[model samples]
Target: MTERGEGSNAALSKYEGYENWKSNIPVMYDWFTNHNLVWPSFSCRFYLQGTDGFVPHTLMITNCDVVKPRVKNAEDISQFNEEEQSPFVQRYKTLIHPGEVNRIRELPQKSTIVATHNNSSNVLLWDLEAQPNRHPVNGAPASRPDLILTGHGNDVEFALAMCPTEPFVLSGGRDNSLVLWSIQDHITSLGSTKGSPKLGPRGVFEGHDAIVEDVQFCPSSAQEFCSVGDDYRLILWDARSGNAPVVKVEKAHDADIHCVDWNAQNENLILTGSADKTVHLLDRRKMFVGGVVLPIHKFEGHKDHIFYEPQWCPDRASVFASAGEDGILNIWDHLKVVGNNNENARAKTRSAPSGLFFRHAGHRYRIVDFHWNPVEPWTLASISHDVDKTGCGVSAVIMLGTTMKMQEQKHGRHLPVYAFDMLRQIWRMSDLLYKPEEDVEEEVEAELIQYN
Candidate 1:
């Protein structure tokens, strides 16, 4: 056991499971908040909840000085706590992004119009209310994109997607192809200054063999979509039929599939996330049944990391949320992990895997991305790759709330202000998993300080 003593006993058992999930965030949260970032934002979004009430829900972040690779030590970083590394964001508004956002998407019919991915193969749209907040220093100057999404020939960063039924834009990269676009006449030049403009491609779709890593759309199709790759295949596109693959699904996920979602209320469901740290659940009408292609319900909960993202829950359709690299964020319910054949519900989910009720280990590191606040309903906005001490690497935007009084006493009355009644009040006030550790922080910062 000397691989630095087995990585210091797995960083002291992931810092004693993040100090028992931070002392059970006040009986598992009725609220939570943490917003800090100087650079490090693979993506975080939630905009659209404004009636001009000054700053009414707007958070589309990115300022990436890249840097990721620190693995902890220094006595596992002096057992953490400096106000958890400061930056509870009291005010923020900046977007000078032109590169290194790696992935950012918003535009379900224009939520401040965005779309970025800058390792590059073109896809930088933005118009956060007409950009121009600057000051991301160190030489500044990258902020000029109101439109420029040319077809990918290579480098596509993280398989983007945007189209809840037109105003389309779908991508997938490293030239493994699947490029579509419609930007509906440039959606009024995406907030206008009208200078970037590049467009192109309304259909490319070749069919992955490697490197697509996530894409989704078919939440009631703007002509169908779905992708996942590094060649563990998932395919399923359809610009009203052409391009290719109306449904592929080979191998589906033994490994590699890094993120995919499409089930805005079950368009025949689909959700993948891999590198094999599981989360399957595919349907698309029985992904092949008799001829073998399966994945009706897998989700083994980040057993050893690698499952980057898997969202669903635009308003809970059997709930969903998953983020990983082992800095957890799970919240499942695929009808209690697929059709209950009730063996006392399979021995109460075999001690934790039966639709993974709720678990969000408050990021000590590696949460990469999260967003499920299609206008606040149990709100969420997570991001992390936490690295501090000036070598920079931070991006956190947590804000969660829960208060499940046994789901309002088993639906005897109220329970619909969003997100599965705060994840059924962190699964019956932390027994589905934890307990003890109070201080709801002024009641989750006065009910999530208007989402900063």
Candidate 2:
């Protein structure tokens, strides 16, 4: 947190008048359909609203097909258009008792929608092309999922993931069980409408001792992935095998392992963040044959360790970002961090975290998730579930650039908001919370910058 009266940023005058904050947002957006647009790192653009005693639930879908110049690479990409031209998201359909939708993962392979549940152990699957039917016989909606994966020992499943290039879905739950579903077998035909392809549990990988919080498939492989759980374990599993994990690291963290991600550009690299407020970089190539081992590299600056995920920059091999309850989005450059001679420090307790490239503390509350834009390396989307005087709410999506034209807050230097202009046009910016070179002006002035 920045001190209240350390002094103001001198450059805050160059890009002035941030007092009218909401007005400077520029683009116009719809309210209803985009209710969940702020959801952090959402795998899919659609969200489910479950019903009450009598009121029916609504399925809100975003206009992914619309145009957002910032999201595109065309000329005058910064131009903001009116309602007709601006992207619009709306409530697409209605749903019956979907039983507390937890996560939605869109499989790139078939455009299938796989959603996990919080009230039941079952997982829901729907075809993106299938239109929702308001009145299906039972609790199922018109856009009923062709498959509902059952068999997780009656534990409400929250951890859900789909193979990046395949129709396979993986789910984990409180039952300490992991179930893999196959989309091929469950493509049963409907009475009238063509049945959307579905998926059913094909493999049940059992080895976890606590609730699984995250499951991610390798970006390069369809059959290999990793899972992290409250048990403090990180296990690598092959889709072909069911009984045992090919490699398992018990006590992978001093506290619960909340999240794990595979580096897309690297073959053997996987990153894990835990309740210990530390991030560990592991190489799968060296496991099992050896006894207990520490991370090839470890990071220790994070304050919120319970629930956060670290992602390798989709464009760069060495850069990655992490967001969590700390309300901070910290970016790191591995080459600069784990250089030519840090091997000796890789000994006992794995001392030093590669230096942080920069930090954006835009969110006044806790940040739940963040994702790097696969197409735009410098762009990122961060979501927060923190609510306070900032009026920040659950599932708030803030998109901004990594190193952008500077924007500062009223009192102090804030990486979260900047007021930079070129010809009176508001450039593409949001709470996407990223540390910019200019944001540290006040921090450096206040002696609040810390790098280790």
Query: Per-prediction RMSD in angstroms?
Result: 19.5, 11.9
Judged by TM-score, which candidate is best?
A: 2
lDDT by residue for model 1 over 1-452, one digit each (tens)? 00000111142234548777766566555445443343344444421111122221223332211011122222332233424322122223555454444556667665557676766789878766677665544555666788888978888876788887678888888888879888888787576654787989888988787778778888776888888887788888777879988888888877677778888876888888776678788888878878888777787866554545688877668778887656677888777646566733674647777777688776766566676644335445565543332332222222222111212222122221111000111112222132212544555566698687
Model 1: lDDT equals 0.59
- Best-fitting candidate, scored by lDDT: 1
Q: Candidate 2, residues 1-452: lDDT per residue as tens digits?
A: 11111112231132133223224233221110111222222212233433333433334432222223234432233233321222322233344435444555556555434354545777776553454546424444434555677768866544777787667778888888888876654443422245434345678888888888789998877788889988889999986675589788998888888778888789688898887767888889884445876687777676654365688887668777786656566777766556645633443334434556655443444555555544333545454442332221211122222212223434222222111100111122332223444664655656654542
Off by over 4 Å in 2: 1-57, 64-97, 133-143, 186-200, 287-290, 341-353, 388-452
Query: Residue 197 in candidate 2 has what lDDT?
Result: 42
> Can you tell me which runs of candidate 1 are displaced by over 4 Å?
1-19, 23-52, 56-93, 96-145, 148-159, 162-179, 182-201, 204-235, 238-245, 248-278, 281-287, 291-293, 300-308, 311-321, 324-360, 363-452
Worst 10 residues of 1 by lDDT: 418-427
Single out the weakest 10-residue window by summed lDDT for candidate 2.
417-426
lDDT of 2: 0.54
